[model samples]
Target: MANDLSLNKEQILDAAEQALKRYGPDKTSVVDVARALQVSHGTLYRHFASKAALREAVTERWLRRSIAEPLAQATGLPQGGSAAERLRLWLDTLIAAKRAHAAEDPELFAMYAAVTMEAAEMIDAHIDGLILQMASIIEDGITAGELRPGRPETIARAIFIATSRFHHPAHAREWNAERTDRDYDSVWELILAGLALPTA
Candidate 1:
């Protein structure tokens, strides 16, 4: 149908994301997105029932891009490395993503907050999966004697929360803004110290 050809769901969602990125959730409107995509408001509504629905979709898309896909990619990496090494790489990747997004689009941080509060369960599930992945790496490290013996899931959950909060721009504005190589090195040292086996 010509109507379907006029505005696909992907385009509408993409436009919503761009709008959120540019103006944040509070300022972004369905009409604005429609205008940005050069489509009538009706076209957007045809795909999304309301502005809130569009926002939810946009938030979901953002999370998938920032968190889900990265975790999935990390899963496929060869599993020969020590758990500490894998965890370090994963944390570094996560922190870098937060910092890059913060510097690239401040509004995205705002949008993240807005959507997170609105869709806590969905966001929590995604985070839980990441924690499980981290736990798996920790267990691997323990088996290799690279890390101290302990419950991997508990440790992973603690590390995930601690690292996430520390890197979260919403909570640690100063740290995120001032993150440098030295900062990253310090974080890695702390994480390794907590999990690594003592040197002889």
Candidate 2:
């Protein structure tokens, strides 16, 4: 119930997110968002070119939450913290965030999963963005002399793929299994050991 004249793009996106949460992505539409804001469809379209564009924007916003803040912390690891610690924090935080989303509302999470699949371009960009963030952390580790010499981009992608189960939407349901935390610990330890330089 937002006033049309005062509405902005963020307001539209917020209303759209709520609509998607309530009616789901498949049933939700630009018109619904407009109705929520008490605006005309034309007004909404003035902000977003099309429904698909709006959906992509919303998806980007959702994906950004998992990357933007966490990447900053991962790249800015505290003094005395190893790259392994930063990597572990990144992976663990992502898993927890995904789990929190599901716990908050399984239906909404499911809707997003579906929307994600439909928005292929946005998903590709999201994955690329994650890889770039991971690479930056890996490069930082190398630069700090905490990790062995190697191609950071390759290592970053390997790490991302290695920890896929913890954050991938397809594996969302299995994240809470009793052994999942144990599994993550084992994987993290293995990666840390592999990446660390051998002592003389």
Candidate 3:
């Protein structure tokens, strides 16, 4: 294989994702990724310590791109807008992102699911990021007098737990159900009742 000096971590990850999609995570190897990149396998080792390391990187990257990044953007609510509205937008962006990722590339999604299960730290970190996004929205709501005053982090954690089925990857199968949106709306309404102020 050529000693491709320009091979960076991003290139390795892109190749690794292709390899995972083509061969599945269990069968893919660092050698396979290097082969795909036309580089020496040892070159990849410089970027990722091992095959497992490469997979973990791929999973983390996917989580950020497909989930966290979009939700991060959703936290930017307009001035004087309802925090409840911003919160709903956050959920909608999250749900749409996951559903589209899963539907458009079932193979990649399955690979992501398998690897993520083995990466608890990665999952926890990802959830923490999402929880922070939730807290930001809740904090804005409370500041605007649209929501009850409470610890935003505490309320965000509770809301995240309450709405897990709507966004969590483990519950992906139920996402396509006819009653899924209605079910989520009912859950959201209950959460809003607890958090939002009633208008006279």
Candidate 4:
């Protein structure tokens, strides 16, 4: 019975995600999800108290699949390359994942932004840990003389914020449309230039 209930919950959440993507969060409702899943409203409510709660669950699931999974995979990649190379690869992987997901379901991007604003401290902590892990990699580069000597945490925070600003549609639209990749490459070059060691 427990397993069956869990499966039902998963199905309902999946249905909710599809509905959100199609109708958007503001327009999506429990009735819409129930109709999509061919389940009764009572059954949907059995898994989630309300549409907002279900939306949160859907957004959380999307984050787990889209962001957490890719980060985990990147962490498992070979780490022997130059620190700068590894950092670039890691950032590129994250950016590519975001771009792909946004292309497939732009509504999901809006959902993520909303959830990030209202999510609990635990969620924020997890995000912080991800940032810190990236910073640790940059610190390794600095120690190896592949990057300049400075505060790794600060540098990491700056790069994360800067890259996010450049790639996020909210900010990127202000810049040239045809030159997004150029802008990204330039930003990365500037970051590396600031951090790379001066050859003797």
Model 4, residue 39: what's the lDDT?
Answer: 62
Please report, as a residue range, the 10-residue window in candidate 1 with the lowest summed lDDT: 168-177
Instruction: Identify the runs in model 3 with alpha carbons over 4 angstroms from their true place.
Output: 1-4, 198-200
C-alpha TM-score for every candidate: 0.78, 0.86, 0.91, 0.78
Lowest lDDT sum, 10 consecutive residues, model 2, at 71-80
- Which residue ranges in model 4 land beyond 4 Å of their true spot? 1-9, 34-47, 118-123, 172-176
lDDT of 3 by residue, 1-200 (tens): 33577667787788899898889878988899988999887778888888888888988998898789877876864545578888888888888888898898787777677666888888889989999998988888888888999999999999988988977777888889999999999999999999987776
Write down the lDDT that model 1 would get.
0.76
Expressed as tens digits, the lDDT of each residue in 1-200 for candidate 2 is 66668887788889988988888777888999898888889889888887777777887787787555666566566546676777777777777878888899787677667767788887877777777777877888889888898998899888888888788788888977999988988888888888888866
Better of 2 and 3 by lDDT: 3
Per-model CA lDDT versus the true structure = 0.76, 0.80, 0.84, 0.74
**Alpha carbon lDDT at 176, candidate 2:** 79
**Alpha carbon lDDT of residue 14, candidate 4?**
75
Give the per-residue lDDT of model 1 (tens digit) for 40-150.
788778788877788777777777788668975785595766677678778877777777776777776766766677877877886888778888888888888888999
Ranking by TM-score: 3, 2, 1, 4
Total clashes in model 4, counting residue pairs 3 or more apart in sequence or in different chains: 1
